[model samples]
Target: MSSQARVSRQIIIQPTGEKPRKDRPMVHYKDRAELKDSVARAARTVWPGNARISVEITGHWSACTGRIFVNNRDAASFAPIVPRTAPETEAFDFGGQAS
Candidate 1:
């Protein structure tokens, strides 16, 4: 996709717990301990038996009118989420930009 475009996205992040509220999909924590606690709580509510979650982050490429789907099942197993490096796309930034 080109650099200039307005995109509409649906980020489905099932974090091994009940689906997050539509208004607030992320759990913010100040520290690692706090994050761990939050995850534990979420696990209790979402999946108690170590069941894994499947994430589906889909959107449209406004520049090209193409569909995008970024998904990861069992995301909890991957402590840090990072796709292996590729030559074409050197960096991945999650921050949304105004178009």
Candidate 2:
């Protein structure tokens, strides 16, 4: 890795539910870069690059939490993180009719 590489990368924050809440928008990103951008934009508003970010899971199951660990810390110390794609939907989504 190059020294110029960003030591402070962007962190992601997302909410989890069986179905997305209609009232509240669920954060979705096209790719990792987009996610990073969103995080950077938010962090810039509040705190500068001095602070580091971590993701947490506050749901029933760890798997559903969609939490990610950037630094040595677990996805709990900071905020919650979610992937661009949901883990369950990663494989395939069932059709209208059941098999």
Best by lDDT: 2
User: How large is the C-alpha RMSD of every model relative to the true structure?
Assistant: 13.7, 11.6
Off by over 4 Å in 2: 1-28, 48-78, 81-99
Candidate 2 residue pairs in clash (backbone atoms < 3 Å): 55-75, 56-75, 56-79, 56-80
Q: Model 1: clashing residue pairs?
A: 17-46, 18-46
Residue 80, candidate 2: Cα error in Å is: 3.9
Sliding window of 10 residues with minimal summed lDDT for model 2: 90-99
TM-score of each: 0.27, 0.26
Going through the candidates in the order shown, the clash numbers are 2, 4
Model 1 stretches astray by more than 4 angstroms: 1-25, 48-75, 78-99
Tens digits of per-residue lDDT for model 2 on 9-45?
Answer: 2233332333332232223333344344444344333
lDDT of 1 by residue, 1-99 (tens): 334322222222343445533332233333333333444444344444544433222232221111111232443321222235533232233222421
Model 2 lDDT at residue 78: 21
